[model samples]
Target: MSIDAFVIGIFFVTIHLLANELIPADRIKRLRWLSFSGGLAVSYVFVYVLPSLHREQHQLKDYASTFTMESELYFIGLLGLLLFYGIENSVSYAQAKGFAEYHAFFWLQVGFFAFYNMLIAYTVMASEIKGVQAVFYGAAIGLHFIAVAHDLWRKDPDRYRKVGRYVLASGIFVGWGIGTSLQLSSVMQSLIFAFISGAMILNVLKNELPKERDAHFPTFAFAIISYTSVTLALKYFFEW
Candidate 1:
């Protein structure tokens, strides 16, 4: 299990780096590929993450002194959703204004996503499921990350190519290094998964559901329908 995680971590980093370089510039192509990515991500959250979080509440009783709730993780997930939505809007506002006074805000986006990457990398590496299950997750996440990287590049080309990609790419290795060494309790793991699940929802939808900017509706719909069907099949029948 440990070796699998470490190896998968390396593969995750490679794919993230490749996403910055390899994804194409066509609108249709982007949507066709990313729709599946977004659907898979969202499906994982609904079918796996939500149920796991609900089942993990007992692990968080030690946190009762801090708060009391059967669904605190869900609450945390909501915060994660709001946080990214706010940042996404703020960054868009700054970019529309020519990013003059607010170039620092672009860096803020980088900083926020660096932590996001680290969180995701840590989660992927720390997962109890190894082999193909972990690889499936990491690759699906890599495709979603490609959308995020595109958004960043679209917002600021020079900076993303020069700096932002490097930051997020580095986060994977850093997170993996940290995760492999840490022995977090179940509560900590639950909180991390909750936050990622929420962030994934916001990030994928924001990019995928936009109808403007030549969004490919046909491809998007197909990807969503196909990927969701496959994911549900695996969950219910194959027991994956």
Candidate 2:
């Protein structure tokens, strides 16, 4: 494997392993940082992910037999959003009803996100994105993972520490392995990218848009403006 890709793979794994510890345990401090990270993720999504879909849509046209239209990727994106939303809603409902601590729901979330992490890592390798672009991708997703990990940790601290984290970390490396060993078609990659974009949007907003008392809008807005400026500068001046 190339050194850059290998390093990126390791970086992703490290994020999963260390994410829970990285966020503050104090509620106010935790929510503030969550707001910051959520902004970073949202900025990256709007600046990079949506545009990526437009570019990849052109390539999707080549595989039109199955998709019929390049815009179908948007439909796929919607499905991605709904899938995570359904999971989140179900978990909430289960918790409300007091379903025996909701172990099943917890595992359902962990399992989905493990595969989600795998896909994130897979795209890192398979897309062959490097240099500044890779750094931003890693940073945004890494911070985003921190937010998600914090949520999972809150759900069942003991269980997450015992089992959930390792599963998610392993998924990163497994995806790296698959990506390095086998390259997928451009169309397939585009489809995955679309799905991830939608999923990412939901995850970030869900985490960020907490009850007004729990949110820190100023911190979130600062992060969004700062990260957005950096990305836009890179795209226009350095053409990253």
| Model 1 residue 35 lDDT score | 52
lDDT of 1 by residue, 1-240 (tens): 377787777776665555556765544465456555555656656666667667666678778886587778888888888988888788789878776767788888888898888998888767656766666666667667777787787777888778778888898888887788886876788888888778878886677554446455566566667766766776687576
What's the lDDT for candidate 2? 0.81
Q: Give the range of the ten consecutive residues with the poorest summed lDDT in model 2.
A: 19-28
lDDT of 2 by residue, 1-240 (tens): 877788888878877777755655554476676678777877878888888878788776667687776587788888899999999888888888989858899899999999888888888888777887777777887777777787888888888889899999988988899889998987788888889878887887776445577668998899989999988888899776
**lDDT of predicted model 1:** 0.73
Pairs in steric clash, model 2: none
Q: TM-score, each model? A: 0.85, 0.93
lDDT of each: 0.73, 0.81
